[model samples]
Target: MLSMLKRIIIGAPLKSTELGEQKLNKKKALAILSSDALSSVAYGPEQILLVLVTISAVAFWYSMPIAVGVLFLLTALILSYRQIIYAYPHGGGAYVVSKENLGENAGLVAGGSLLVDYILTVAVSVSAGTDAITSAFPGLHDHNVIIACLLVVFITILNLRGITESASILAYPVYLFVLALFILIGVGIYKIITGDVSSDLHAPIGTPVAGISLFLLLRAFASGSSALTGVEAISNAIPNFKEPGPRNAVRTLMAMGLLLAILFSGIVFLAYYFGIAPKHEETVVSQIAAETFGRNFMYYFIQGTTAMILVLAANTGYSAFPLLAFNLAKDKYIARMFTMRGDRLGYSNGIITLGVTSILLIIIFKGQTEQLIPLYAVGVFIPFTLSQTGMLVKWLREKPKGWAVKLAINLTGALISFLVMMMFFITKFSQVWAVLIFLPLIVLGFHQIKKHYVAVGDQLRLTTCEPIKPIEGNVIIVPVAGMTHVVENSLNYAKSLSADQIIAVYVSFERVDEKIFEDKWNKWQPDIRLVTLQSYYRSIIQPLTKFIDTVEKKASESNYRVTVLIPQFIPKKSWHNILHNQSSILIRTFLLYKRNVIVTTVPYHLKK
Candidate 1:
């Protein structure tokens, strides 16, 4: 059933030829994988505001500390995953790390988390982009879900076509967004420092609700940390890089990490400096842009760039999801379809599946960025904790040179990630507990599926009790339709069996024509007795069963073994089965039920 779903969702499994043609270079691959982290700069600030809105107005100032903490954690994670890329350059991501160091179950859990995270990434990024665009053009607010889904479909098609193509197209817009944002922040800061900045456009005192607490603080930090969601995507695509893959991948990751930190931190600072208050309906980026440039051309540019980045941010999931899914498929934790590449040598099926799932989420959530933010952090942090823990175990087990340093780094990362996850659970339980529950159920389902495969394999074992031998006094019963290639093949097969007696049997819905029999006999070169059976209802199984029973009775009386050769046409196309034909399967099944009888199929392959 899962395999069927994989096909329906992802298309056909990819072949080696397809993969060979679609191999991605290091620079292009890095850009594709890093898109998610880079795009987070646009909406990461807004997510901070989402949590702070329920607290006191002072909670808006908390963006600074949350950004700082996230940057600090982001730096540590980058450094840690640099080692991951170096250690396993073959693109395992969290699953590879946990499987190698922790255990298979840990790997499965990591995979489940990563899968959920990738889906959330798409929905969140697109929804956030839609919010930015709507903020810029209020007329678009009502159609946000429609627009978000359209973008998802567009990205899916691009990804399905080829990774390199998608990367090349996305890189220019991403770079533009980065430049535009940095320019906006730099100009905004200059205005503030020069005493040229105007009155804040955001609400004044009593903007946010009162009664802020530590819970709201933690929620704000968790929401801001959503910017760090796609940090691990590059680790999964390391193998797609050029020679010295891990080295180049590590370099790319560091570059992405530093750039993300600067951009996200700069945006948050600008938003705070401009007195941008947390509002359930507004995005901080757009709010900052309107305040800084006052709806001018530059402000529009910033808003446009923010929207572009948010949309492109989903490209990060496009690259990472397929790679993670491929690894899961390789480990048999996911359906084998994910392991298959497309003609473009990409995980096309997985890409489309992720796109479709994300689109559904966008529609269901009505493209509300605030609502999706809670579900976003949980999946990402689950893998973050497991991967960090796996690294800690690796440092302990291998005891490599500078093992103490590595262990400390891993331990710190694991501890911090776990605390964040726990806090997210406590603070956002009503909003995100559903994801936590669903992820484990998915993990358990994979385990059950694996067990079923193992049990079936055990049962299918060929035991020593069954031995091969030639039957004495072999009688061949050839069940055929009108003289065709299938019947000819059956006669040849019966000859090869060296049967003591051979009879060609035919089932008819009505009386057999003598002239038809005479004509068939004339064409036959190998001599064999002909027998006919009549079925009033034209049912093949019932008549064939009766004939087989009579043959078994005679065989028992003569102490001879009977071998039935049923002629069948091998279907070359999926639609070929619609044609009316005798059911050879029924005849073979009935023959197998009788003792001292062996059923052999003589098949004629049909042209497609």
Candidate 2:
């Protein structure tokens, strides 16, 4: 029943041979991988105005300059990561680049930061998407957190189904979103050119309540930096593309960057010229749409697509996190389960884990995008800075053809990212303190996991010349509940083994006639010795475990192996298991850790 439900939700199991066929093309890959970066246009420029508006009404005019700065950084990052895609086509992104050019510690830091960023991506994107919905229907505003969590679950299941499947499912809304924004931008530009401006276009700018400082500009820049969060995703997932993976990935990266630049700049420019102010009940983009299209079908269409693209933006995190986790797991820094592929050939464990974690963040932050934004950009820029620095180091060391130009590009990216990261730390220190604290702790956790795996390998490893030690014989002890077919089956298997002795032991809480028990044992004629012990406390496992311990000590003294066979009867239906005694399971659980003791369950299947 459970299997049928899983099949229905996630679809049929896919074959390993179908993996190459699952890769996405440039058009579909752009939609899937770049949704997070593109969707940031829904909120990125707004984040800048959100910061600047707090200082004074006139201060919001500075959003254009801040946005231009963000665009410059985005260009540098696009150039730097295209180089990354070609340099390491296998695709580990910043983590691999830093680890190879830099050292192990730098690699771990980059990996940890990316992990945090991916999780935040899901939380923030979904929350902002929910905000768009609530903006359209104020009645749903109170339930936004619940709505955001449900969206995360939906996207997670889509990704778990397979990469190609999700790309096909999500591509329509992504393209529709881009088209909607383009229409909005083009119409808004034409209105400005033809002087069909809004009624409030010439409203006087408000007086400044406070003077603008360098710190204020930096704060706005830092806030707007969220626009660049998903730019690194393409470099990290080159293998997800079809033939000519590196070439396809770089092309997609360039396309995503170009789209993001135009969308972000156009939105910021329109919002400034139209004099759209940030509002508590509605989003900046929503207001711009209302001003441009006048609440018609076009206005609602823009809102619908914006909400969809924002919600689907979480798809970027779903796509990248599992692959990043696979790389980390391959390096032995995380559990090996993350490295295992499911029936669909997706990293099921990593996908499910990312979903659960982001849901938790959404719940904790109450699904407020502004509240979560403070903790967002810090994780992003850490890896951006590290990736640039790692590439710079690589160029200096290799000095390949055109290395000088590459070095200059990466150097500029590294410096700008580092400065922006420092501004995030300084301006939002109170909110981002937790992320700063978690970065080192997460790296330390990676080291500890690696140390443990290394130690286990050392113990389990064997040399070619090493000789095996032989055991003397087996001492079999079967823990029985009573004389039944299950006991007979266990005793038969024990007798088949070449053992020195075989004994059946039982623990009874109620007093029994010794003479009657012995008579019954003799009547059975099983030819196996039976030992029964009375338990004063009515505890079955404690008394049985003690007997096994005594037998193990004696067996170890003689260099013999001790085997404990637990007999149990199988129920035809899984729900029927609750009707029977579970003492055999308890006995097996107790003897698991005993020295020189091996516990095995002998099942007697019921045809019913």
Candidate 3:
């Protein structure tokens, strides 16, 4: 049943020839790999508002400043990641960066951070998207968790089908939403600056907080930083691009950075200009849309587009988690299952795992965007800081012509990112840290696993030993059931051993059929003499033990050695035990009690 389920999940094993036919090309690869970052524009603005709503009604106006900060960080991150693409283009991302420069522990920290961040990306994006849809359609407001889980299952199915397949379907719609967002923000900005926009527009039906403190400002900044989550995704995907992969990847990164900055900043400014304050009860995007576009076509349009983009955002984690797992697997830090690509040249297992985990988070949090937002920013910034610091370490080690300039840039970026990460941890720790404790635990688990592998490798090392001397009059009595495949294999194996003499014997229970026994013996036609001992009580173990004891007594008296060959069939299938049973282990145990007799097994494979 488990095998059947595995087959259903991953499909039947493909022939060698079928593998090459399914390889993904550059365009298709980019679609699959780039979707994560491209999808973030949908919920990035909403996340900022969620944080600000807790402070004061006017805090939402600060979304513009928060977006500006995110844009600045995004730019720095893109440039830094471009360096990463050029330096480690084989695709390890943060792991490779830290390992090459800062050492293994640093690499593990980076990898752990990236892994946690990817998971949060999926959960936060899907939930936020559901929130947008629910705002647009009141009926769905109560079923957020259910809807989010269904979306996750749908995405998992799409991914299971293959990377190129999912990419081809999701890419156009994602691009469409990107373009639509650009238009909406651009037009909205124009209307705002020209004083044509209505100032009476406010977030629909939800009260904004009245007072704020310094802590509120910091919290808003951290929440807004969610927009920066997918900035590293392109760096991780560098190897998946076309030839001149690093250069193409850098270009893609720059393009993504510029687009994200413009769209995120523009939307935040528009939301603030129109008095769309963030409220605990409703998302700022939904509130703004309901005001600007009314409860009619435009409001629904923005909501629908946001939902599509959010669903697609999960593609980011889908692209990242597999590559991260692959890198760890290669370093022996993770299981080998992650290292192999699927039939469609995708990491199907990793993709499905990410999807399932994201769905579980959705269910646990009941798909509340507000609830999940607190847990979102820390993991991402932790890696962001570590990767940026790694770049500084790399820059110092290389000491290039522009070393001083690059060092300063990286140092500043690292400091800023690190400070923000600290702020996120401090302000949001109680609210979200408990849920995130698993991140460090996962890292510790992988470290222990690596240690176990090292220990096993050390234990298995071979050493030189003296050769055995043959004894005169030594007889190896190998017990057999019949001339079955296992028995024949055992006889053949024993003959090749450095033994003085070999003897084949069979023991039968009282219930055994005489005709079957005779036919089984005839098949092998043993070159060596065969002996059979019978039991009156239908107990093979007791009879075999008595026979071996008698043979050993004779051998000991003659100063000879006795060895036994036990034939055994190891059950492969779960159902095989119902059809046939063997007592090789019991017989071997009895022989061990009698001194001077050696026992060995010849195994036969059973169909699984």
Highest TM-score, which number? Answer: 2
lDDT of 1 by residue, 287-326 (tens): 7777777879888887787788778888888888888888
Candidate 2 contains a number of clashing pairs equal to 0
Q: Of the candidates shown, which would achieve the greatest lDDT relative to the real structure? A: 2
Listed in order, each prediction's TM-score against the native is 0.77, 0.95, 0.74
For all candidates in order, the CA lDDT equals 0.79, 0.89, 0.73
Candidate 2 per-residue lDDT, tens place, 1-608, comes to 88999999999999899999889999999999999999999889988988887776567668877988999999999999999999999999999999998899999999999998899999988998898898889899899999999999999899989999999999999999999999999999999889898635523444344688888899899889988889999988888999899999999999999999999999998888888888877888889999899989999999999999989989999889999999999999999999999888889999999999999999988997566676777888988999999999999999999999999999999999999999988988888889868889999999999999998887678853456568888889887776788788888889898679998887777676545666687788457888887889989888888888888888888888889988889998888999977877877777888867898999999999
Q: How accurate is candidate 3 locally (lDDT)?
A: 0.73
TM-score of 3: 0.74
For each of the candidates, the C-alpha root-mean-square deviation to the true structure, in angstroms, is 6.2, 2.2, 6.9
> How would you encode candidate 3's per-residue C-alpha lDDT over 542-576 as one tens digit per residue?
76677778888888776777778788887887677
Candidate 2 clashing pairs? Answer: none
Q: Is candidate 2 or candidate 3 better by lDDT?
A: 2
In angstroms, the error of model 1 at 348 is 3.7
Top-down lDDT ranking: 2, 1, 3
